[model samples]
Target: MRTLPPRIQNLTNKVSAVFVPLTVLLALSAFAWVLVIDNDLPAAIFRGLTVALIACPCALGLAAPLATWMTAHRLASRGIIIRSGDALENGGTVRHLYLDKTGTLTSGRFKIESVTTIDETLENPLALAAGLEQASTHPIGDAIRAAADEATTFDEIEPVPGLGVRGSLAGDTYALGRPDFPGQQPLPADTMTPNSRDKTHTIVLWRNEQPVALFGLVEEERPDTEAALNTLRRLGLNLHVLTGDASTQAAAFAQRYHLPVSTALMPDDKRQIIVDRRRETHKPIGFVGDGINDAPALSEADLGIAVHTGSDLAQASGDVILLTDGIAPLSDLFRAARETRRRIYTSLIWAFAYNAVGLTLACMGILSPAYAAIAMIGSSLIIIWNSTRGGSLWLRDEHQLTEEDPPTRSTNLTA
Candidate 1:
């Protein structure tokens, strides 16, 4: 599949755009100068041809793009899908990481704790809540829908960014989200206690601006979460969490991960935080998320990583999609990006060096047109080989990847 062009590739194109005309002018100058001096038409023509061939810019154009393409292909083979060359280039440079709490660091499979209804008139609050959450991709919604007997449809379902969902069911306005979610009036007099200290999240359901039901859910960390965090720490990334969860829940998650966090933030708040951090540090920032609410931050960050199981909108906003379960592959991603960049620069340097030396020799009459053509082809071949070499190494048995690791299922809905 075609991916977005890398910055280096665009630079190469721009350079080639200018270099092509300059090359033609230089070639014509060499031809005219040699003909005027020696009066040898054939020799002058050969000299001009040599100059043109030597200045082809073939190697220069291939250097960065080839290396990046190879890196992206290798990553795809390992179940990591990089949607853009810029993402691959920036992945290695991310110094700070902001991660969404739910469905990103956690397993995303929520266990239903309780579905309590304060209103006696409501026939089945869980069913109503499930109906509203049916259109939601959040783990909490999934849990609620799974527990309900059947999910009925709602009209005009609208998601409140960083909050909850609202819709019309049976000609009545209903909402489901955090207790503090706007429009949820007549708050529970008993103080909707947070059981987040015990790893549980509380969500309130409202009908006509009145509290109807509360859903308590518990989320567990993924099996590979700790290892991923450790790897990121070793890489020296400043880690933080941005979540719309309650302060108590956010604090619990942050404390568990030993990361500073911003709690009860809107989607815009998360995006603004990333913007501010980028301006202050002047460093690449990464945001990892798996929900609709995280789309804004994902799009704003320098590197946006989405889990494969995330919502379609979240995946669309991300630059990189992790197809493998958990976040362990993130460490691999950074390492591969660094390696790709190294290859890109090394190939570019080699290309430029070849052009400089080859052009000098061709112009000085030390090299013939035929030899210059051969040298030009040789330089391009070397760049191609170098670009493919690192990718080939990924197939070695020592790398531990087996035949069963499918590479063709990049768009599959699994993590």
Candidate 2:
């Protein structure tokens, strides 16, 4: 794989560039000092050459990129696709995480519990709702489409980010989305009932700017949801849920997970909240989501993490994509990022230490140029081994392979 570096790696390169010329100047100074002190031309030149050879920047250059490369490889094997090394570093620094409600915290597999329609003349309004929602990427839309027998296609199908979808069918306008999306017409008192029951969501259908039908959906939390959130909390991340669900339902969900929440948010609202929080805290924030409405906030976050089942636009906006189902791998991702950084720091310290000792010995006439060259190569080898040991950032149990389990071992890489 090609070397993809984070900002720290770029900074390392700049430091290495400056060190090269600085080391050359120091080597020249050592040469002149030796010649003046001992009046020995051969000894002065040898000492200068030893200093330069010992201070070669190979190890310094390898320190950052090698560690990142190893970490990225490990992440890929574990079904996490990071777009760049920057995501790995950013993931480590995230102090807060904003998660979307549907398809993210809850299982996206929605079941159509009830489909009611006020239009007495219309037959099979469920099919009509499904037809309009067929083009939608939302979990609710997927459920509608899955439950319908056949969907009638529409002309000019358009999806409004946080609201719902709209299209023209048979020269009449049709919309299937949030209740307030289609028109100002009041919904039936029963259809507008508060979603007091657990795990229930609602969607409204409109025909020619009039409410026609309401669909009730039930989505259960993923089995791994509790474990994933617990792991994140243990890692010191302040969790928040930003969702378009009704306030009551949102509050209930938030209370269950013990997370702060913002309910009834549009895509723009979600994005603006992230922007405002960034200005207030000045700390890195992460957003995890898997829907069309989530694209805006995902793009606005310090790190955008999308699931494999999310819309194409969402995946494009994400810096990191979780290829596996459930967010259990999320904790492992942060852990790997921290470990990668640790390895890089360890490698750099060893590199600098090698040069410090070698330069001191060379100036004292105790180390020869041949020994200096060998020491330089040895330093680089040590860094390589440290960065790529066991070909993983963390180890996992071999006996269990499940969504809730930590990362497992994979093919090893050669240092």
- The sequence of per-residue lDDT tens digits that candidate 2 reaches over residues 1-415 is 2246688889889989998998999899999999999999999999899999889598889988888877878889989988866887888787778889888888788899887777877778888888888767788888899999988877768888788888898899988887768363758677676533666777888888888888888886798798777777666567788899887778788778777788889998988888888887898779999988899999999889998889998998888999998888888787787778778888888888888888888888899999989988888899999988874335442232344334422211110
**Number of backbone collisions per candidate:** 2, 0
Best by TM-score: 2
- The 0-to-1 C-alpha lDDT of every candidate, in the order given, reads 0.81, 0.81
Worst 10 residues of 1 by lDDT: 406-415
The TM-scores, one per candidate, come to 0.87, 0.90
Q: Can you give the lDDT of residue 328 in candidate 2?
A: 86
Please give the distance, in angstroms, between residue 159's alpha carbon in candidate 1 and its true position after superposition: 3.5
